[model samples]
Target chain A: MDKDTLLDCHRRISPHIHRTPVFSSRSLNRMAGADMVFKCENFQRGGSFKPRGAVNAILCLTEEQQEKGVVTHSSGNFAQALSLAAGRIGVQAYIVMPSNAPQVKKNAVMEYGGEIIECDPTLAARESEAARIVKETGATFIHPSNDMDVIVGQGTACLELLEEEQNLHYVVAPVGGGGLIAGTALAAYYFGKGCAVVGGEPIAVDDAYRSLKSGKIESNKTTDTIADGLKTQLGDKNFPILQKHVESIVRVTESEIIEAMRLIWERMKIVVEPSSAVALAAVLKEREKFENQKVGIILSGGNVDFRFKGRP
Target chain B: MDKDTLLDCHRRISPHIHRTPVFSSRSLNRMAGADMVFKCENFQRGGSFKPRGAVNAILCLTEEQQEKGVVTHSSGNFAQALSLAAGRIGVQAYIVMPSNAPQVKKNAVMEYGGEIIECDPTLAARESEAARIVKETGATFIHPSNDMDVIVGQGTACLELLEEEQNLHYVVAPVGGGGLIAGTALAAYYFGKGCAVVGGEPIAVDDAYRSLKSGKIESNKTTDTIADGLKTQLGDKNFPILQKHVESIVRVTESEIIEAMRLIWERMKIVVEPSSAVALAAVLKEREKFENQKVGIILSGGNVDFRFKGRP
Candidate 1:
């Protein structure tokens, strides 16, 4: 993607994304060995940073494209985000999920007026059904990642975070499909390249970490972690941007993820999903590099079910 | 207290108390027969409106009073708030809590650097233990409600709500020790008496509702509800204020509390403790009076464990 185009994406979707608050934590700072400023994307609309990219994807569609609707295969935050943002902007959204997706996510999509299409759990089954839905309905396919518009939307987080604190010495976020980090890095490149943009991951699904290190998108055959949102493979679009821009990739254990989640809840008193816990895990896991530096951690999402463990 | 003192508190603690956002749900409107604006006190500092009173109580202490440290007996939120706020300003905090209080609350007190002295469930045991702790430690007792400073702190929420939207039609909140209602009534008195203040209670602990009817503080023989915070009888200081300021009281069943909690988490996407649910439950149960009018329901706290039954 061209620099000017990325800048235009930032400009076009400016009003849609929430300029979430930057919170200071004396307790976290003392604990993490750094002065910490948390950009509260956990409080974002649809309860995650997906709205940025979801809106970007919907907004980029030709007027005719949005009218026909958009389809994606996500059982969680992405489904809810697409349904909500698309619904807000008068775009119909078709959510494709496995038949056994959580009732909560299903109810959320329906509440937002998203059309649901069920498939078996295999990727093959989902892709075939998603293809059929698009062909029959004439809807555009808004891949959760691997799309330019969505990448730009996710980048707005960096734009908003940078807008709040321009001189931050470091920026950290968890990496999954890399849409968020890619966008974050783009925003940091234009507004804050003087600062470091780092990525975090659970060692269980270290695809993003390995991909950034090896200069290729990587995948885990069978991932295992309690953070359902971080199970996706790095997208082709996301991998390049991350390989070039993300300063470092840190891996945290499952224990670290749970510990970080609890620690953040105890101190910050905010309801953060485990994906958001990843960025916090990085800061807590790698304390030496953060000492005395003004660090920014993007709490990417807060869509975790308090009642049930989401990951398989 | 004088009008100037109460008004002064409104100004002093304005920045500290989150003018908590008011959320409305069209779906909830359909169910409750009103366009409801839920004031999210669950999002407040220390996860309840208790901090407003706790902070106010701590801030108003004389230099001599401050040196003595602050002591309070609370089963939950007040303990956490007193611990958190008092510790922040370098004031020593001692909390007396029943041994049966949730693990989360115990964690909060310790996290806030409070010294917790466990006591039996009975008020007699709690009071004696608290007095003993205060005398031994040379601490000043900051009663959770039956005190002017706590009432003043609780009043700040009403002040902010009224200040933001002066013509609000009805205000509702759960009745515990009546600190919140006492504060709210005073705030509502200054803006508009035409706006009715509704106190909500669970049937299991309907003491406040009965007290308002009998023209005296009432006590429950035994309390049974997930809303542990709302199980207390009205205090001497707060009941009179409730009598003078409140317009009416409403009661909800135990099941309604769970349903109300689910409504908040599902629709507004906010995690509210069971105590916060009672206010919403009142509006939900008595759908007629609130219908079409602008109503404000304070989601007083979010410290409840969001556990579904059958969880380990």
Candidate 2:
């Protein structure tokens, strides 16, 4: 939407979300040969940046609308984020998940006070179930990454980062459904002194990268990436914002994402999911452009399952 | 060692080590049922609190001794810490490692500019090689946990913590060779308003707990615990310090340590070695003693290798 909307969203959600710390490592700096400031949303409420948008979206609704509660169809960080955020604001949350969703993910959602509505293991089933709940309960449907309120809310992380370090030359974030990068791009455009926004996408699910070249929405033929969070395709609501203000997107290999994730876990001593690593991997892959520049990286989430080998 | 020595050590090592952040989580606070503040030395230089002691010991050396450098017998965090500390002070470091030591550990030492001397897997061989190196090069020998200067240096972490939150009711640390817990006990006794010091020990290798009961330095019959950093026997230098000032040692099972470590990784979103988890495990095991109290827990280190199941 507008800068005012994003700033207002930040103000609304500030009390509910963490102004997560920015971390740096000397060895990591030496390895990338760049000055990197990481905005650790891994430490954010619900272990991800999703709560920023969820809280803002819920808070934006009128008391009457809020009284009706909210509904979302997802089995990822947003599910947990929405549940936690809604719980924090005293609003009921209905989370529709596929039957095949991992029990751990469902457990996390339940822990956050979300009412789980299990459907058949299919996208159509999830959406239809969520629609039925919304219809029955008069609950507002909040799309994970495609709502204007959510995008504005997500932008607050970048706003906080730029406020801390105004001289950053670039802000980098991993592109999944494009919400984070889009919000990051807008935050940089309005608040940053001269910062550019870059998106890192896994090559296996490079919808955002392809969309940038095609000048339209793109879809993935096969979602096979270690960064499970980035497997979702970009949606219409955030794509226009991404197209107008975002810089070029960089694609990284699965091996590179793993290497970057390991480096972060080893060097920075912070646990970040593989999706978060994609942004750092992009910077390492294209170090020449960012050499000696102060770059801010948005570590999107840290909700990883140690049981799974990858992409849980 | 006294309070003045610890204060001086803090000043000496202030420029070299990081004043790591204190982190708290709502879920963790609920789990422990206490106001737990984590002193994250896992984020310290050399990826652990070991550097605090290593640097102080190296700096305490005479100019002549510093010129010849320092030597230590270990294949753990101490080896890497000594090398990095010596390199920082422009001194040579000789590291005596068991032949069975992992290559990754050796590589870390080399990366920090330590000259590695391979020895038989036995502790006697490690000590003899270190002795030979000392004789040949006139390098001062520094025990990982037994030296006075190192003990005082290790106490600096508690100094910083108490300085930040003076109202802490107790300070807890994982008891290894009695260095961290001993130093922590002294810091709490002198600097803390009325804080007591508690030590966490593994049930498999409950040397510290047994030592506290027997009033003597006790050795582990079998060091089969996952908290490998704490398997070493308490030395004469630190044991007395631990005996006089420490409150009590709480023993936790290996499963408890893993559960605590997982909670920290999942909820706190920090990567800590299994040794570091022992303190939190102890806290969880004895929740009544710390109920509603302001407790400070020192996360000793974050130098874990993911390749092995444990104790890398």
Candidate 3:
């Protein structure tokens, strides 16, 4: 997409999303030996940046499509985002979630007024259930990350970050379904003076890293990472954007992800999911390239399941 | 302290402390049944509002006292704040922490360049150890929450809050050593137009409530609360301020505090210590009294020791 397209999408979704704040920690800077600015999407509505895309995709839909409602299959932040976005826009949202999904996730979607359609705990089952709902209710199916409108909407976060801190040398984002990284790359390419885009991926599910090396979208053989959100493979729509704009993809191990997540929570005093920590892990893993440079990292989400207990 | 005293303290400590942001949540507002603004001191330097007081206390010290260094007996946020504040101001800090204090806390104190002297866990031992250190080294002793300089410093948080949201109907703070609440009460009295001050005390250690009723300083028979930072009793210096200006004290049970803390983590996506949640818990417990009113709650700190593990 061009600059106007991204700018237009941002303007369209401005009223529906939060311009989440940018946070920095001296301890974190010392640890990485880099000047880092964290764009905290953990503070965004639905506790993630998914709302940017979900709202944009829904808002871009035709009146007829809007009236028919929107449907998606996700047991993660996207479900909550779509549900909340649709509810706010006075549109119905049908979330097809696996029956084995966490009850808290289900409750969150329902709290946002989304109707949950349960299916078997598999991609085939989820997709089939979503298709069935679309046929039965004339609902429009919105891919969590594959859709272009969603990608453009997701780019607005980086747009907001760059607007506030224009001199960032590099912009980093976690590679999930590739939407966030692709959108971030596009934003940096167009708006950033000379900012290079980078992706942080889990070594267990390094599809984006492999995809970039192979010059095509790649699939993951196993999704066995603590960063659960980054398990999905890249799609055709966003793959090309990553290929064109993204400079490199850095892979981090599970321990590295966990350590980074803990550091952010302990040092920054903010709750962030493991997927969001992947970016910081990547930066710390390869600090020499980023040392003494101003870098921006997107904390993609904060929907962590933490149990509060009595002090030890 | 009057308005000018508070103002001057804020200005003096302004360069050293953060003008922490005020956060609001629709979900929390809905639950509390009042429009609430959270003055997030949890995001402050040293992960608490203790720096405002620690820095002010250090800065107010005479040139000779600063040269001799500062000393305090604590194993909490104040220890870290004092260490960090002293380090920043180029003064030596001798922190008399109990030998049984958490290793992580000790590491934090050393990381901020504070020298730690181990003492027994009892209050008497802590005081004696601190006094011995003072005698041995001639270091100026700074109380965690008792001294007038520290109290005025702590009040600057409420002053910053009032500056941003002047029309708040009431300001609520957790009463521990009484410094935070006393400062908040004075800030509201001077800066807010008819704004009332409220204290949120743990039901398990409701010394503040009892003291307010008895018209004298009172001690807790048993300091058994999940909010570890708030286990101490109010001091004479701050107790008088609380008695004169605080409108009421609301006590919240352990369960209510846990629930409020969980809500902030789950919905607000910020890591707040249990003591910070006490203010919100009190407001939710007394919802009818604050119905449709604008309330300000100071989230006291976010230095929680949470163990991050694999997802269930």
What are the runs in model 3 whose C-alpha is more than 4 Å off? A309-312, B309-312
lDDT of 2 by residue, A1-312 (tens): 667877888888888998999988888899889999999999998999999999989998999999999999997899999999999999999999888889989998999899999999788888899989999999999999998888888899999999899999999999998889888988999999879999999999999999989999999999888898999988999999889988899999988898898889988889999999999999999989889999999999999776532211
Candidate 3 per-residue lDDT, tens place, B103-130, comes to 9999999999999999889999999999
Candidate 1 chain B has its poorest 10 consecutive residues by lDDT at B303-312
- Which pairs of residues collide in candidate 1? B33-B291
User: Candidate 3's residue-wise lDDT over A8-47, tens digit each?
Assistant: 9999999999999999999999999999999999999999
Positional deviation of A6 in candidate 3, in angstroms? 0.6
Recovered share of real interface contacts in candidate 3: 0.75
Give the CA lDDT, 0 to 100, for residue B64 in model 1: 84
List model 2 lDDT by residue over B119-215, tens digit each: 9999899999999999999999999999888888888889999999999999999999888887888899899998999999999999989988998
Any residue pairs clashing in model 3, and if so which?
none
Model 1 Cα displacement at B121 (Å)? 4.3
Q: DockQ, per-model, please?
A: 0.25, 0.50, 0.67
Which 10 consecutive residues of model 2 chain A have the lowest summed lDDT? A303-312
In the predicted model 2, the residue pairs found to clash are none
Cα-based lDDT at residue A246, candidate 1? 85
